[model samples]
Target chain A: MINDNSEIILSVRDLRATVDGTEILKGLNLEVRAGEIHAIMGLNGSGKSTFSKVLAGHPDYEVTAGEIHFKGQDVLELDPHDRATAGIFLAFQYPLEIPGVSNRDFLRVAFNAHRKARGEDEIDVFDFDDLIEEKLDVVKMDASFLDRSVNEGFSGGEKKRNEILQMALLEPALSILDETDSGLDIDALKTVAGGVNQLANADNAVVLITHYQRLLDYIVPDFVHVMADGRIITTGGKDLAKQLESRGYEWVLEEFRAGVTA
Target chain B: MATVSDVSVLRTADQRDAYLKGLVQIAQAAVPENLALEEVRSRAASFLNEQTFPSTRQEDWRFTDLSAMLAIDFATTGEASVTEADIAELRLPETAGAQVVVVNGRVSRELSQLGSLPEGAVVGSLGDRPELQSQLADRLAQASGNHEVFTALNTVGFTDAVVVWLPRNQVVETPIQIIYVSQAQGDSLLVQPRCLVVAESGSALTLVEDYWGNSTATHFTNAVTELWLDANAQITHSRIEREGTGTFHIGKTVVTQARDSQYIGVAAGFGAKLARHNWEIYQTGEQTTTRIYGLGAISATQHADTHSLVALSHPHGIVEQEHKAIVDGKAHSVFNGRMAVAQKAQLTNASQLNRNLLLSDQARIDTKPQLEIVADNVKCAHGATVSQLQSDEIFYLQSRGISAPQAQRLLIYAFAMEILDRIPVETLRSRLAEAITQWP
Candidate 1:
C-alpha cells in the first residue's frame, strides 16, 4: 500500500501481464513519484516494451493478476486513450504511421482531447497554430514539417523528435519515453533530452524506457531500475547507471549469483 | 387504376416505339439548335438504329447486365420548375462565386446565380453558344468515337449543357458549382447533361458538378464533362455523384492539358445501382501535369465500375492516379486504371495505383492497374492491391474505447480520406467530411 503523503502518481503491485497465453510481465512491482525521473534499462526480450504497453492499456497484453493505481484510480479499467487522457503518456518505441492525418491536426486533436477530458475548452484553429509554432521550436522542427502526414515518411530522428513534440504539446503527468533514444544521433539525443528537461516539473514525472545506458548520460535519470526476466531486479541512485555503463549487465548478474550463493 | 390502360401496350414493340417518338419530340423542342447539333443527333440515331440493346456478351457489361435496366419503359421527363426553397436546399458550403443550377437536364435561369462573374467569364448552356459548338463537334469526332452506345446516345440526345469560358489571365475567386437534381416520376427517363470548361492562358478556375436525385423510384443518369486547358492555365474539377439506391448512372470526363498547364480531377461515387465513370486525361503539350483520384463506396446489390486512362503523348508530361473502392454486402466494384507513355514522351513520369477493401466474404472486386511505357527514358509504375481491413487496426481502435461500428467507420473514413483530402475546395471537403461523419 502507498502512504498517504508519498506523492506517488503510479503504483503497480505484483503486476503480471500476458499475451497469447504467454507470460510477459511476471509479478512486476514499481512506484513512480512526482518530480522524479526514472530510467528502466534491460536487454532485448526482457519485456521492457510489454511492461510499458501493459500500463498504457495495450489490448494485446492481458494482465492476469495485478493491481494498478493511477492517481488513486484503478488504471486496469481505463482504455488506451483514456489512460492517456488521465495523464499517462507512452511514447511508442515504434510509432504508428497514420497516413492522411496531418501531424499538426493529430497533435491538435490529441491536445484538445486531453484538455477536454480535464474540463478545458478546445483551442481554436488560430490559437492552435500559434501553440504548435511555439512547441515546434522545442524539437528544432521546421514549420513545414507540421503540414506533412503524421510520421508518414519521417526520418529516424524526425520521428523521435515528433514524439517529443507530442509529449510537449499534451503535457501528460507521467510521460513514459519508450526507447526515444533509439535511432537518434548524438545531436538528436541531446535535443530530445533538452526538450524533456524543459517539461520536467515538480507535479509531473517522466519514465525513460530504454535499453542503452548511453542515453542516461545525457538525460541523467534520478533513479535507475535494471529489469531482467520481466521484472525489476535492482534499483539504485544515478551512479548505478554509470556503473552499468562501464561494466555492462554482467556485473549485476555476478552480484545476483553471489547473493544467491550466500 | 392506370395499369389497366397500359397493359395491352406493354407487350408489343410499339410500346418502345411510342416512347422513343415522344423522347425525340422532347429533345427537338429543348435543343433544336443549328446544323452541328443536328448532325450529332443524326449520327446518334444511326448508331442506335444499327445496334441492339446492350447485353452480357460485352466485356464491360458482363457484370452489370443492362437488359433489365433498359426494360423500364418510361417517357422522357419534361421541363419542371423549381422554387427558391428547392435551390436553397441544394446549396453547397462554398458558393460565393458562380452557382448554376440545371434542373432535369436544362439550365434553370431562376435558380442560377452568375452575377459575380467577371466581364469576360462565360456561364451558359452549350445550346446558347452556337459558335463554340462546331469546335466541340470537331473534337468529339476525332476523340474516342462513341464506342459505348450509352455515350453515343447521350452525345446525340444532349439538350442542355453548362459552358464556362475564362479569358486570358482572368482568375475566378469562387468555384463554379453546377447543381444537377433530377425529379423523375415513376416512368423511366434518360437525361444527358454535358459541361464544357475552357481556360485561357494563365487563368485559374475551379469547377464542381454535384448530382442529386430526390425521387425514391428508379432513375437513370448519364453525364459527361469536357475540359480544355490552354497554355499555363490551371483547372480543378470535382465530381460528386450521389444518386439514390435505384439510380443507374454512367458519367465520363475527358480533359486535354496544354503546355505548362495543370489539371486535377476527382470523382466520388456514393450511391447508385450501377455507376461507371471514365476519366481520360490527354497531355498534348510539354511540361503539363495531371492528377486523378477516384473513390467508390458501394453497398447492397450495387455495381460500380470506374475506368481511367492517362495518355502522355508529349515530352515532359507527368500523370499520377490513386483509385480505391470499398465494397460491402453482395456488391461488386471494379477499377481499371491505365497509363500509356508514347515513344516521343521522353521525360514523362506516369504512375497508377488501385487499392480495394472488401468488407464481406461474398463481396467482390476486380482492380486492374496497367501501365504501358513505350518511351525508354520515362519512369512509369502501376500497382494494385485487394485486401481487407487489418484486424490489428480494429483491435487498436477498440482498445481506445471505440466500439466495433465506430471503429469500422473510422477505418472506412480513413480509407476514403486518402482520396478525399486531394480535393482543393475547403467547403466541399467539409461537406464530404460531414457526409462521412454519419456513416450508415
Candidate 2:
C-alpha cells in the first residue's frame, strides 16, 4: 500500500550485516518513503536495534551484503558523519556522557558541520545562542542545560530530551529513533512524541524502533512491521500494533511459519 | 680497575669537563660584592663539582634520559643582547601588570616596566636592590638544595635574579608578570634564569612566569624559582613554558609555606624538544594549604617530564595535586607525583592523581602517583591512569555530523580543558585553549 508519487527517502534490499563475525541483520528488506512514519517492533535479540545501527554505518557492524539508497544516492559507501550531513539522523538509546564539552559548544559544532556541508554561512556564538534558545523550547528544556557538559550527570529523562533537542536542531530528512522511549516515563514520552510529530512533515520521514507498542499509541505510524530473526516477517497497519500489544508476538510468529510452510 | 666501557668513559669525561668549564667561567665573571651571595655561589659550585649529570641509571631519571642534553657542547657565555622589539611578540595579550623582562638570564631594565605597586612592595632585579640581600640570602637556596645537578647549576650560573617581594600586610592589586626569553646568539647557549619571591606575613600576591624562546636557535634554559610564604601569606603562581622546539629546558620550583599560609601553583608545558620540570613544596608550619596543578601537551617526537613532590612536615597540613598529559604522534610524556606526610604531621590530608591520554599508536606515557604517610591519623590517596581515546566516543560525536578530526579535536580539547579551566585568568585560559586546540 505504498504511495507511488511519494519520494523514496530510504530503500533497503536484502540487507545483511554482522558484528564480530556474528550475523545480526540477516536478509532484511525495508523501504521508507517521504510522508510516512514506520514502526519496527521486536522482542529482545530480534535485531531491531541492530537494524538502526547498521543504517547509521556503525563501526562495530559490518555490512556483508546490502544495498541502501537514500534520496537517489548510495548511502552504504558514506561515512557515519557524511551520512549525517546527507540528512540522516539516529537518536541513540543511550547518549554518551562527554565531560568538559559544554552542551552549547557541542550543539554548535554539530549544527555548523551540517551548515558547512550545505555551503551555508556558519552561525557565530551570539547567533547560535539565540538559535538554540528557540530549539530548547521544543523539549521544554531550561537554558541552564546548555552550560553543563553534554549529557554528563543528566537523568535518563533529561538525556532523552537532549536527544530530541539535537534532533530538532539538526532537522534531518530521515530520522531513526532506536528505543528512544524505553527509559522515559509517560510524561517524558508524551513530550518527546509531541516534538517528533511537530518536526515531521510531508518532505521527511521517521523510523521508530522499539520493543513496546506503547510509543505508537502517542504517534500513530503509517506502517507497522514485526521483525523476527533479523527479518520482517509481517507488515500491517496501526491495528497490528494494537493486536500485538493485546496479545503477544507468539501468534504472529506461528502464523508466519504456517504461511511459509503452506 | 673499574670495567667502564669506552662510550661510558667518554660520556663521563665529557660531563665532568662541562661541569668544570662552567664553574671556571662563572667564577671568572663579575661577582657581586656581597659576602652572603659569594658564599652561596661558592657552595653551589662545589656541589656541582661533586655531582654529575644523572642518566637513566638513577631512579628519578629512569623514564627520562638526559643523554641528548649532555651531548651538546653548551656555551658558557651568559650575555645575549635582546631589544624591546625582540620580546614584543612574546608578551601576553590583554594582561596588564608590572612587567619584568629577563633575556639570557640577565634582567633588562630597558624592557621592564615596574609599574607603581602597593606600599612596601618591591619588584626589580636583585642586583638593583642590594638592600634586600638578607631576604635573598635566607630563602634563595632554602627550597632547592645542592643535591640536584640542574638546581645547583642554576644556583651557580645565574647572572641576575628577578625578585618580587611584599612586606607585611601589603597586597598587590595586579599580578606581577616575569617573562624569560631565551635567544641564542650562537650554537648551544646556556641561560640560567633565577627568580626569588618572598611574601611576608599577612600579604598577598599573584605571580605569572612566562618562558619562551626563538624557534630558530638551539639553547639550554636552566631555570630555578624559590617561593617563601610567611605566616598567613597567600600566593597564586602560574608558570607557562613554551620554548623553542630544538631547545633543552630544565626548570625547578621550590615552595615553602609557613603556618596558616596558602600556595597555589598552575603550570602548563607545551613547547620544547626535551623539557623537564621539578616542583617541590614543603609545608613547614601547621595548618598550611598547598595545591599544584600541571598540564603537558607534547607531539611530534617531543618529550616532556614533570616531577612534583609535596611534603607535609607539620600537623594539620593539606595538599591536593593533579597532573595530566596529552601525548600524540611519537611524543612521550612522563608525570611523577609524590605526597609525603611526616610522623609529626597528624591529621594531614593529601590526594594526588595523574591522568594521561595517548592519541597515537606510537605515543607513550609514563605516570606514577606516590603517597607515603608516616602519621597514623593521616588520610592520603594517589591514583594514575593511562588510556587512549575511545572509538565509541568518536563515533558518537561523528553520528552528530561532526567530522572525525573535528570530533577528535573536541575530545582532546575537553580533556585538556579540565586543567585549563582551573586557571583564574580568562585571557590565559583562552590563549592556552587555542594552543591546545591547534596542537598536532
Candidate 3:
C-alpha cells in the first residue's frame, strides 16, 4: 500500500488528450523513476500543460485512449481529488481562489486525505499545527497567511510559495509543478526552488513543467524532454535544456524536419 | 365602528374597523386592569385609519401584487389553540435560552420556556405590559415615510406579541426565541403578529424569530418587529421564514441603534407563496454600527421581496448590508437596498450589495442597490449584479472530474459563500448551507 517498489514511480504510453473537443496532446510517452527530477520545455500550445493536466486528471480534458500508471496502478480512472490523495500532487499554474476556506484548513484537509489514503493515522489538530509550522519555515511564509482565504488576492510569488508549502505538507510520490515559476521574481523563484528542493527525496519524483530554462538553473533536473505537437520529440541529459535555451524550439524543429526529409 | 359599510372601497376600511374592534376586545380581556394602555391603543387606531394598503400602482408594491390578499374575505384567526403537534415542531437547538410560542397571534404560555433572566430582564406580550406603554408607545407608530401599509395594519390589528426588555448593565446569555406559527385552518384566515425588543445601556442580548405555518389555506400574515438598542448595548438577531404555500406574508422590522451600540440582523427566507420582508435600520447615535445579511431561495411560481434601508443620521455611524437570492422555476425575487448618510453624519461608512442567481430561463430577479450621501466625509458604495453561472467555471470544475450538476451546485454555493461565511454563528451557517444544498 505504501508503493515500496523502487522501480518507476510513473509511466505513460501514447497519452492522447483533448480539451473542449480540441486535440492538444496527440501522442505522448514518458517514464519517471524514483528520486529523479524531469523538466519539460516547449513552445506555447505544444502540449506541455496538457500532459501535466492529463496526468493530474483534470476534468475538461478527455483521453480518447491512453495508458498511465502511477506506482503500477492505473491512474486514468482517478478523479483530480483522488489523484491528489493517491500520492500525486499538481501545483496548478493558476491556483483557484476559494474565498471562504482558509489556507491552513485547506492544507490540513489535503494532508489528512493523503495520509488516510496511505492507511496512516490521521494527523491530530495539534500535530498538524506543529507540522505546518515547521513546513512554513521552508517557504518563509508568515503566520498571517494561514488565516487568509486560499489563494485569494495572493501575489504570484506568494501563490507559488504556497504551492511548495503544500507540497511539503503532502509529500507526494510524483509531484508535478505545472509552471510554478511563471509569476515569480528572481528572489521569489529562489525561495520557492529552495522549498521544493527540501521536499525532494529518494522516495519521490518531480516533474517540472515549464517554458523557461531559468527555473532549471535553480532546481537542476536529471532529464530534459522536448515536447512538440502534443508528443515528446526529444529526450536527453541536462545539457538539452541549455541547448534549447540558447537555440530555442525552432532549431530542434528544423533538425527534426531535416532528419525526416533525408 | 363606522355606521355604513359600502363594500366597494370600504373593504379595507371595514377590515380596519374589524381589526381595531378585535384588538380592543382582546385588550379588554388580556391587559391588566391598572396598565394605562388607552393612549397606545388610540394612536395605533388613528394610524390605521390614515394608511391604505399598497397596490400595484406603487413602485415598491409593483411586483408583489397584493390584490389577492386585499380581495380575500378573511376573518381574524384569533385565540386559536395550539395542538400537541404544533408544540412538538417548535424545537430548535439554539433556542434553549428563552422561548415564546405564538399560535395565530396569541401567546401560548404552556408551550413557552421563559428561561431565567438577569435582573431587570422583562419578557411578556406587548399588549400585556402597560408599563412599557409610557415610553415606546408613541415611537411605535411613528411615520416611516414609505407607504408600508402592512406595518400600519400590523400596528392596529396585533392581538398578542412578545415584548423583551433588558435593563442597563444586564446581559441575557440565552437568546430569546419567539416562534410564530400559523395553525389556522380553512380558507380566508388572517393573522397579525407583533414583536418588540428593547436593550438598555450596556446590555447585551440575542433574539431569534422562527416563523412557520402548517395549513395551506389562503391567508394573510401582517407581522412587524421593532428593536431599540440604547447606548453601548449589543444585540444579535436572526429570523427564519418557513411559511407554507397559499400564504401572503409581509414582515417589517425597524431597528434603531444608539451610541456605541452594535446590532446585527441575519434572515433566511426559505418558504413562502408570496412573501415580502422590509428591514429598516437607523443609527440615531454616534459610533453605532449595524450589519444586515440575508439569504432567500424561492422556486416554483412563488414571489419574494426583501428590502433593506439603513440610515446613518449621526456622525461616526456605520452600516453594512449584503443580500443574496437564488430564484428558480417561474418564481420572481426582488431585493431593494439603500444606504443614506445625512449631512451631519460625517465619518460614516456604509456599503450595500445585492447578488442574485437565476436558475431557470423563466425565473426573474430585480435588484436595485443605492447609496445617498449628504455628508462629504462619508465613505459609501453600493453595487448589484444579476447573472447566470459561468460556462468556463463550470467546465473547469467538470474537467476536475466533478459531474455537471455537482459542479453547478458548488458554484452556486461559492456565489453565496460571501454572505454565508459572514454569519457569526457556525451551526446556523452550516444549517443554512445544508438547506441550500438540499434545494430541489
Candidate 4:
C-alpha cells in the first residue's frame, strides 16, 4: 500500500556529533519515509551506532552542527523521553539489566507514558495485563518472563527479544534496531527478524543498523546504504547487500576513494 | 586507662561534665522508686554517674559527631497529656493487630489493645507487672553491657518499660505493634522508652515498633530494646523510626539467641536531625540463625548512623547482615558492621554487606565492615560499596518513555527492594515503600 510517494517520517541533514570532545558523526545525511525498511551497513567504527544514539538524544553525544526533524518538529530540542513519547523507539544492542524491577511493571509504565503523552486515558493494571499478553506473542516470549526482573539474568537472545517486545508495546512510528542480531543464534535471529517483519506496516518505518548481510536474508530492505568514514559513501537497491556480501567492502572503499580524488 | 594528671584535666569544665550534671538532675527527678528493677536501675545509675558521653576521639563515635546534640539542654519530663483522638491519628492505616501505645516514656493503658492476644502471651506495662520480676532481673541489660554510655543512660533514666512475653510453646498468629509517640509542650524535652521481649523455648512472635512525633517541636528520643530468645524460639523484629526532622533519636537493640533459635530484624531509619541505632547480637548456643537487614534514608542536613555487632561464641551458627543507606541533599550516613567468630565457633558462616547510594554531590556515606574469625574452619566475608546513580541506567529507562525523575525513583526503589522484600509484614513493607517514594 506504500510507495516512494509516502510521507517522510525522519529527515537528517549535515549531522555532526561528538562524544567527549571527539567528533564521530561528520556531515551525515539521511531520510526515512513511512512504510520503508532501510538498512545501514558499515564496517567497525564507521559511526553507525553513534547515529542511532544521536537520534535518540543521548546526553553524552553532543550535536555540534545538524538539523533533525521528526514528524515536522525539530527533534534536537526534545529530550530523550519526549522523543520516545513522540513515536521514536531505539532498540539498544546491549540492554541494561535493572534488578528488582519486574518486566511487567516496566512495560506498564512505558506503555502508559506514551498514552499519556498523546492525551489519552491511561489503562489500569488489569486492562494492561490483558494488553501486554497480546504483545508477548509478537516476540514469542513466555508469560513467566513478566515476573522476573528486567533482563537481570536473561540470556543473550532473551534480551534482544525483550527489546523487540518493548517496541511492539510502544508501537512507534520509527523504530531503529542497532545490531540487535549480533549476539543471537540462528533460531533467535529468525524469531526476532520475524517479529520485526510482522510489525512493519504502511504507517511505520524501521531502520536496521547491522554489519552482516545475513539479517537481510530474513527481512529484506528497500534500500541499503554503505557507510564509511562517518558518511554514506554509496546507496543502492537490495542487490548491493549481496554484492558487498560476496566481494566485501575493500572494493567499495577503493572505488569511493578514487571517485573522491577524481 | 587515664593518668591522674589526665583525669584532673578531664575533670575540668567540659561538655562531658555538663552532660554528667544534667544526668544527675534528671536521675533525681525522674527515677521511679521501689520497683522490681530497683537494684538493676541503681547499678545502671551508678554506672552512668561514673561514665562520660563518647566523643569523636572514640572509634565508634568517630564519624557521628554529637556536638550539636550535646549543645542542647534537654529536660526529662513525665507523660505528656494526649487525648484519644491524637492517638488515633497516629495509628497505621488498615493494620490489624494488637497495638500498644507509649506516649512520652509512659504506657497509655486506655489506648492500648490487648484483647486480641492469646492468654499465655503478656503485653503490659513494666511498672504494673510485678510477676515478671525474676525474668526482668535476669534478661534486662544482659546483652548491652555498661561499655556504651547511651544504653547505660537509657537504663538509668527510663520511667517505665513495655514487656512482650511469650510463654513456652506459645505461637502468636498476629503481630504485636508498639507505637512510641514523643511530644514537647514548651521546652526541649527528652524521652526514654524501654522495651523488653522474652520468647520462651518453642515460642514464636513478630513484633513491630514504630517511633513518630510532632513536627513542630524539638525533642530527643532515647530508646533501648532487649530481646531474649530461648532454645528453639523464633522472633521477627521490625523497627521503624520516622520522627520529625527537628528531633534527635538514639536507639539501641540488643538480642541474645539460644540453641536452635532464629532471629530476623528489619530496621529502617528515615527521620530525626541526628539519628543513631546500635544493634548488638550475642549467640550463646549452637545451631542458631540471625538475619539483620536495615535501610536508612536521610536528607536535608540530617545525619543517620547504624552500627551493628554480631558475636558468635558457639559452634554451627549462621549470620547474614545487609545494610543500605540512601542519602540526598546535605545528609550524611554512616554504617559500621562487625562480625566476630570465636575459636570454639567452628563451622560458622557469616557475611556482612553495606551498600550506600548517594543522590547528591554534597551527600556523604562512611561504611566499614569488619570481620574477625579466630577459627580456621569458619567462612566469613564482608563487602562495602558506595556509588551514585548510573547515567546509562537512567538513559535506558528514559529511552523507554519514562521521565528522568521517574527513572531515578524507580532505580532507587529497586536498589532498596533487595532488603525491603524480605520483610514479613505486608502492610509494613508497602508503607516503607511509600515512604521511600515520597522522600524528597
Best by DockQ: 4
lDDT of 2 by residue, B1-440 (tens): 55569777777768766765664465336344542387777787787767766778788999998777655667756457788788776555434548899988878888888765766788889878777877677788767444688887777667788998899989886878899999866778777889999999989988889898757577888899999999999999889999999888999999989999999899999988889999999888999999889999999999999999888889999898889999999999998888888999999988888889998999999888777888999888888889888888888899999988889999999999988887766677888899888886
> DockQ score of candidate 4?
0.87
lDDT (10s digit) by residue, model 3, range B143-260: 3522355675565456776888888989887777788888664566677778878888999988878788866777677788888888999999888887878778889888878899
| Clash pairs (backbone) in predicted model 4 | none
Question: What DockQ does candidate 2 have relative to the true complex?
Answer: 0.84
Ranked candidates (DockQ, high to low): 4, 2, 1, 3
Least accurate stretch of 10 residues (summed lDDT) in model 3 chain B? B23-32
> Would you list the C-alpha lDDT of every candidate in the order shown?
0.78, 0.87, 0.78, 0.88
Listed per candidate, the RMSD to the true structure in angstroms reads 5.6, 2.4, 5.6, 2.4
Candidate 4 TM-score over all chains jointly:
0.96
Tally clashing residue pairs in candidate 2. Answer: 0
Clashing pairs in 1: B74-B188
Model 4: per-residue Cα lDDT over B1-440, one tens digit each: 99998885576436676786586467446867645366776777777767767778679999998767667778886447776787675565433448889988888888887778889888878887867777677788767544577887787778788999999989998888899988877667888899999999999999889998757577888899999999999999989898888888999999999999999999988889899999999899998999999999889899999999998999999999999999999999999998889998999988888999999999989998988889889888788999999999999999999999999999999888878887887888887887677776
Tens digits of per-residue lDDT for model 2, A1-262: 2566999999999999999999988899999999899999988998999999888878999999979999989988899999999999999999899998999999999999999999999999999999999999999999999999999999998999999999999999999999999988999999999889988899899999988889998988999999999889999998999999999999999998999899
TM-score (chain A) of candidate 4?
0.98
A97-173 per-residue lDDT for model 4 (tens digits): 99989999999999999999999999999999999999999999999999999999999999999999999999999
Candidates, ranked, TM-score:
4, 2, 1, 3
Write the number of the candidate with greater TM-score, choosing between 1 and 4: 4
- The best candidate in terms of lDDT: 4
Residue runs of model 4 more than 4 Å from their true location after superposition = B1-13, B34-36, B87-97, B144-146
